[model samples]
Target chain A: MKIKADTTVCIGAGMCALTLPEVFDQSEDEGTVVLLRETAPEGQEEAVRRAVTLCPSGAISAS
Target chain B: MSDLTLPMTRQRPFDPPDEAAELRQRASMHRLTYADGHVGWLVTGYAEARAVLAHPGFSNLAEKMHPPIPSRLDLVEERSRRGVPRGFFLRTDPPEHTRYRKLLTGQFTVRRMKALEPRIHEITNSCLDDMEAAGGPADLVEAFALPIPSLVICELLGVPYEDRGQFQEDSKLLVNLETKADDVIAALGRVTAYLHGLIQRKRKEPADDLLSGLIEGGELDDEELTGVGFLLLVAGHETTANMLGLGTYALLTNPDQLAAMRDDPSVVDNGVEELLRYLSIIHLGPFRVATEDVEIAGNLIKEGEMVGVHVPVANRDPSRFPDGDRLDLARPTGGHLAFGHGIHQCLGQQLARAEMRIAYPALLRRLPGLRLAVTPEEVPMRSDMTIYGVHRLPVTW
Candidate 1:
């Protein structure tokens, strides 16, 4: 799986941070998406996918 | 009708003094039980706490609270009949609760929370900026916690922000457990009256807020609207408000955790989760009455018993949450009891989580050099109330 983030559309609800802390982070100043990694690192895909499913805004997806 | 088939009534006293942690300990630890003339069987053990929360036998519909809430309603025998909808979302069991919940379920989805993210950050930063301008001594509760969510819920519910002060006071007094229970009831009535005013305005000229949306959509009747509105205003504002204040206090004192989060903002997510689990404010949370005689964890709870669901206790339950007793951000907390479980679980949870996830990191990053203005021991804390929050969290950069 590959991890891709669309920070432009991310509203920063921060569930990605909650679920997939390794691959995604939030800019605290304005709660914007801050990607930790663009690719699914090792076994982090499942977590990234969970983040995508849990993203309320449909702002993220895992390929 | 009180026959051999149904056991007699029981009452359990769960409130404790000074230390809330110890109170939960006592509730879960001892065979502590109390019996009153009217109120049914009360369950106090950790196992029983979960049982009470999830038990279908427990009825939220029992009209008259045998003991009565306070003096004015003393002879009232029963609490009160459902003047509003028979079962509004929070006051209903599975199917009804589930049905009513569906109305607002999509509202808290991650996408919805994301849309509100900018608003939350704006609320927090602007409040902090005001605090900064006000100089050293300001109550974090008043300046930050109270406003951010108050403003957010107002924006969401379509409350005119300028009129928030009066309604905010209503919300505050309504939640004060020390206030005479009757006065709280009166305050609730005032709030409903206020909501009626808002409903009228929404009826006249529809706006983009939740109230207007609900009204124009005709999704709920006036009574349902009042109940939902009241719940949202009080639950939406005070609960998160308390968390923000208490959470700030928690993080500020836990230097290791503070430094860890500051070092890597990524920790904010887990840090907020742990903070939420560790310092849940609604200690008198999720009250329920047993509908029928039921057995839980080897104990038989007689029909009509009342029980208070303690989230903090459940969160600290070792059986469910490993190393549950301690506040460890590193602990694998897949599910925490912070927002609760079942149909009645907090509706505003996603929004709450979004605010905290934003507030904690921003506060830390904004004042990376921030330090407690007073010792943790000296710092003001509120343990006496149902809502756990510091009176004032004094800090400086």
Candidate 2:
């Protein structure tokens, strides 16, 4: 699965980073979503989906 | 249209009000009657709640909204007053809300909150130590649940923990639905003045804390700084305190669920989310007014009309959460709106989570013999208050 994170819309609740740190990190200054990788690693697709669902702002999406 | 009034009676302590659940079953959105005879919309379904919260057509401005219950009318008026003190962004809509919220977002990021986990552990263990020393037949609410978050927030904001007694009482009055308008104003005044004094002191002698950090940022004026401090101080403690106390009661009663958490260390993360969803402590959901005509879940909410989301009901919607009534700790509670949803979703949620993640497990591990000292029915519920939870949880370990 491929992930996309929009920092502009991200309110920085940090669900993505908390859910899957390897794939998602928050910027230190603004705390907006910082996508570490575009594609989910093997066996981590489920968690990536969960992160996208959990994001309060709908700033994260996966395809 | 439903005849049911908002803030329906809770038949069971752990479940949402029966009337609310029934309303949800009938439809996601209902034309709810407010206490003052104002006909408004109530969103009960999980998807509906999420939509209303996420929708930009809704306004959080307190002046435009009506309270679902009569008692809260005073609160709405007090919050909606002209020139709502700067930094009180919860009641304001973007770009004003956006400006205030963004200033603090970085402070509560996932990494920063995780970094504070160690401090949270320390605070939790210390509270547990005090509870143990005092012996088992203590009110867990007073001894454990309240202090863990209280102290954590105090330390984080650089507010002296010794002053908790003053702020705690003031905060109680502010959140109590029954508090009179005059009393609410008094409480708000006292807390704001206290924060203003503290901010002045911090200016003279800067400290290493969030409040000090804000001062260093040089963004907010004195009044705004006081407003921000007031929000953090009150929001930081009361919500989490109720969660910790009420969550413990939930665990002790549901031994199977508690055991699952204790037996497996990994369940703590999911367990916290499940507890948040199950309890859904914020009985009164966020109130909003339609900025323009909007249709949600086949229901039309017109401009200038009010909308109240019944969070407890929405979180338990059968469509979103199968076996919605059950308290299953292992359930994948990813999308729960316990902290709410959308831009105004709780600013302090990450910190609250870090505290709970450390607290519940520590309590279970430290007090294996913990159980209720009084009957569950005897525990005083905060049904009269804005935030729902036990007022006092008497427990004996």
Candidate 3:
């Protein structure tokens, strides 16, 4: 399992695409995080590492 | 040695200021005084208010912070005069608050607040059908928590719902802590001259909302689109109409969490994240200014000192909410800073959690014997403002 977000430490605060929308999504023109899956899918890796610890701007990262 | 001043007021209208939970149980930073008496630092735990709101060496400019009232230094001298765009980047910090929070974070997304959840369930059933045709003992903070986020932030900032009674009397004299600081800088310069005449009528008629899609995209100018439409019309309807009037007075004074959220309407999205973590209503939480020297949670923050944080004692920090003063609508209420934490967090926090999950289960399943017309010690509480909440709730079925 490996994932990433860091759209330059995303401040969109979308809370990692509103809590793991199948491995994050956003950016309808700069709302930030849009990493839609770098790995986690089968059994959604603990809901993409709990949406990377509910990203209050740590800008997600799973490994 | 007794001057802790900054918003440790409540004295229990739903808790949180037992001198900020006894100064976050005596550690997570302390020394306080401001209101211009100039003594700083306050934090109050939840990991020192998320390490001074995710420190970029803590600084949100206004002369490196500290006026948590002293009429917020007349709203920082009425947003420092010429052109007024600083009134809210939650008071600017990063790279000029990273270009007006990247153009208001694509106008608040979580798929645009879940496609504004069916127009927030048809504006919460037409404000519970105007509180059931104004019959039973109403005043639910003026017919349903100030017109359901003031008609969904005046239809998401196109404004003109008959100019919402002069922008709700210029956002109630710019948030009423007994007004006067030159009448809150003349009611925030009459909401910045009514958002600079609605951004010059959305640049000569460009409607279809969010200030005509920020004037059909030219990357903001007219004083940064009237300072992002006066900070989304006063932080999008005064913090979700004071979190739907103090989360319906803490669920009509917690009658079994309002009959377990009106008999499990799937606990209305963990009962709106446990009523935004047990009504942590925006209480005096954003101020910082260490911009050169810092060291959090184990003290020593110097360079031009001042910090405030406090958000209802860091969202009731019982070491980050394990039974943090109980309001458990099925607990694990995710990391509550109640729409604040890092990078000036709370760009309409998912449209204020989709207007409190569609206005608290449609005002508890359309007033199924709603209850509370007074007597939770006669309601009142906006603890002389700066946003605590419950200026008038008064309900009934």
Candidate 4:
């Protein structure tokens, strides 16, 4: 699975990083998503999918 | 009960007013009479309130026409106009609101707020220190609840911390329901001038703050910049401060919850969410005018009719939250409208949550014996103002 975060649209509501810290991190300065791994870790796909849904700005996607 | 008014003032500070509770039980929405004698619809159901907030048919532009307070109509009109001295995007609809929000979204992302958490802890500790030095019976509103968020917002926005007293006075006038039109206008003028000068300074010397970031970004001109700054300054502190004050009151009065928070470290995150849902500090939720006819929960709300969501009542709706009226710290309280919903939900919600998450535990640990300095009945609640909270939370440790 591949994960992408659109920095322009992310409002930094923080749900992504909070839900799946292993798969995603946030920029300290910009507060937008900083993708930790392009592909989801073997067992973490469900968590990553939840983060995408929880993002208020629709800034994250996984496929 | 066709002539129900919005926000029937609470006799008990912690719960929704009796009239509001009655309306919520009767139906989700009711035809309402405004202080101006204009008729509208009041939504008191959780699902209905979310639908109204998220639906394009309901326009936030209604703030100009049907402001909750009778006396603020002129001020609201001036503030809601197209170009000059515009109200915050809280009063604007889609494309316009979207544009303004996009400019600042990057500034408030969750990771950015998390980076600021250490500073939030420092600020909370400093306030507790001040309270400790002042001795017993300190007004929490004056000492701890108000200042922590105030200082943080001032630093975040690049507003000089020394000038907080002046802005605090001006902001009070702006939100106080009984404030005279002349006073409100004068305060508005002063705040506008201060922000204009500050924005110019930022243009010349961009600093490491949100205001400086907006100035360097080049998407906004002076007036829009002032609107954004003024909105953030007022909103950034006020709502969260109330949550701190009123949430403290709620917990102290309900000892079991307070003990639960004190004993268990894990409950702090969920506790803040519960407090937000229970207090619903922004009690008079945003008002919107139906731009077109739409049916909500079997009710036909006609075009141009104003609609409002009573957040406290909707949050406590039994159908949505099991045993909804009771404050349960352990409950999974997601989907609450405390920060509102839809595009205009809240820009600083993550920041607010971070502050609450840090501040609450720090206070509990620092001042373990903290309790009310006066009886609950004696504490003055800010029912008449736009935000609902205690005016002074006198506490002793």
Candidate 5:
């Protein structure tokens, strides 16, 4: 699955980073979501999905 | 129209008022009568609570909002008239709220908060050491629960820990539902003035702290800085302190859960989330008003009508959390509304989480025989405060 993040709408609640740190990191400057990888790694799809669902601002998604 | 008032009294200290569950069972949203005679909607179901909080149609603007209970009506009207103080973004909608929230988000990122874990541990250990020195049968609220977060926030804001006596009293008055409007205003004035003076001092001598960082950002003026400082100071300490106090009370009462956490350190992260969900310390959910006509949970809410997300009830919505009333530390507790949702979600949530994750485990390890000194019924509760927690948790190890 490919991941997408829109930093403009991200409030930086950091659910994505907290839930799946391997796939997501927060920018030090603005604390917006910084996708560490464009695609979910094998066996980590469920966690990537969880991260997207937990994103409070709907700033992250996976397809 | 139902005549049920908001914030029904809790018959059991650990549970939300029984009326809330009954209301949720009837429907996700119900007609709510506010203290000011304005009939509004109360979102009781977990889905509806999330919907209202995340919906753009709902606004947190002071003019559009109403307090769920009667006691806060005067304060609400006063704030609406004067307008929300600059940098107090909690009462404003985007892009206004966006502006203020953005200025502070970087300071509270997951990584930034994680980096503070060591310091949080140090603080927790220090409090535990003090508690040990004091001997058993102490008021945990005064010894352990209150100091950890109070000291953490104080050091973060560059505020003198010596002045905690003043701010803690002022914060207590600000949160109490029974505090008179005049007294509430006086408390607010004192906190603002104190923060304003601190900001001026920081201007002359910048320090290595969040307040100094904000001042260095140069985005906000003196009034705005004071507003920001006021929010962090009051919110930072009280909320987490209650969670620690009440959370310990919960674990102590449930020996199995306490043992589970104490035995297996792996459960600490999810355990903290479960405690947050179980306690749901902020009893009165964030209040919002419909900026335009909106439908929530198949119910049509008219424009300009107020809505309160009864969070304690919403968190306990069985549809979202099966056996919601039970405090199982291993429960999958993601997406709970304890810190709220959407852009207005708690800015200091990561920091709060860091504090709890470190504090709870350290506390349990330090006091292996920890249990309540007073009988369950004797412990005082902060039922009258905006944040629900124990007033005094007498405990012994």
Candidate 6:
């Protein structure tokens, strides 16, 4: 399954981008939050879940 | 326990019932000493909760005492020696509180709150977009809950929103008891010092924001201006951070409530109110010392005894909110103590409400089927902390 990130919740602690750079990136201007994935990679479902689960702000989710 | 003198009897800063049942089972209230024998009262009943909060006998200034301009004051002596005002009005009574509060009031008027709705919506949507593109289950706290208000409050105050990441780190240290008091105090000194500079700049170039307006008016002294800015940042960020975590936890756990809001977007307003009341994340508010000997709920409080009005209990009081346990979107009241009451009520409440109202509906609609990826039992809750919330609220749609 693919997902879209909930960026408003991002404190830009930069943990998600650090953990999964391929799928997530921090915004250059605001250092707010940015997501490279319009949808998750086919085999990366568990890793994506880990990114969501580990978020301290509870900002991200999957659809 | 010994009848220890309240080393810091000072001024600072809710409840109810089937509340009777809940009160009976409440996380037992105790009159304990904090950080060196500061004697304060703790009330858990909903009715008395409001009464104590609104009570006049309580004092807010900690470093100052009555009659005993002794060689040493209590909790606040060091801070005052360093020239910090007794503390934020979150610890004050009117008319002094009135003076400090007035400088910041124009920012929280209902009309002002109403105006922020659109901007709050803009911030909320931006955050929702970031979360959506991440793909799969994610920690709602790190990803969405914390930043939404960080963006909203920073924008409202005209602080660089991006700086929150670093400010948040310093904030954690500032609020952490385990951190060296000196280091934490130093962090606070830095944040306030920076805010003072920002307020100075705002005076020269007024923006259409609260900080600039407050600074340009020249009503708040440099000390109060510094203090207010810090309060806004700490209170602004800390409380809402918990609200986002706990509110989402409530929704994710209560599938029916989630579905109801999902089906009808308009319910978001009431849902937000109920969540604020129910969660009441900022559990222990400012400590108020008894300036004069006073009595609360039949207990004779001696002069200089420390006490605080716990909000979760007050907001949950049955008199103020009947059927308090159920999270009803339809119910409304005189107000929720969640933002607090009277002169010292939260100045940033409107901003907090605006952020929640916008965030919840946008989140629900965009991620229509949002649900907990983990069972409620598996999810970690922050029981040890005074603010009731989870470390993370893992969700998926």
Count of backbone clashes, every candidate in sequence: 14, 0, 0, 2, 0, 59
Q: How would you encode candidate 6's per-residue C-alpha lDDT over B224-341 as one tens digit per residue?
A: 7777788788777777777877787787667788777677876777788788887676533545677788776677777877666656665766666887767777676435667665
Question: Could you give the DockQ of candidate 3?
Answer: 0.23
Clashes of 2: 0
Worst 10 residues of 6 chain B by lDDT: B8-17
Model 1 CA deviation exceeding 4 Å by range: A1-63, B1-48, B62-78, B81-88, B374-380
Query: Which digits, one per residue and each the tens of the lDDT, describe model 6 over residues A1-63?
Result: 666666444444344554466787656423334778767787887777867654434556776
- Per DockQ, the best of the predicted structures is 5
Best by lDDT: 5
Docking class of 4: acceptable
**Model number with the top TM-score:** 5
| Backbone clashes in model 5, listed as residue pairs | none
DockQ of all candidates, in order?
0.05, 0.77, 0.23, 0.36, 0.84, 0.01
Compared with the true structure, all predictions reach lDDT values of 0.65, 0.88, 0.78, 0.82, 0.89, 0.64
Error of 4 at B208 (Å): 0.9
Q: What docking grade does candidate 6 earn?
A: incorrect
Regions more than 4 Å wrong, model 6: A1-63, B1-40, B64-87, B318-323, B332-334, B375-378, B384-386
- Work out the iRMS of candidate 5: 0.8
Model 4 alpha-carbon miss at residue B71, Å: 3.8
- How would you encode candidate 4's per-residue C-alpha lDDT over B54-100 as one tens digit per residue? 77787776344666556666656655553336536666776787678
TM-score for model 3? Answer: 0.32
Write down the TM-score of every candidate.
Answer: 0.76, 0.97, 0.32, 0.90, 0.98, 0.73
Question: Between prediction 1 and prediction 2, which has the larger lDDT?
Answer: 2
Interface RMSDs of the predictions, in order, are 9.7, 0.9, 7.3, 3.1, 0.8, 15.2
lDDT of 3 by residue, B25-90 (tens): 878778887876778777878877887787788777665555666767665555444324553666
Q: Could you tell me which residue pairs clash in candidate 3?
A: none
Chain B, TM-score, each prediction? 0.84, 0.97, 0.35, 0.96, 0.98, 0.83
lDDT of 4 at B8: 58
In candidate 3, residue B336 scores what lDDT?
82
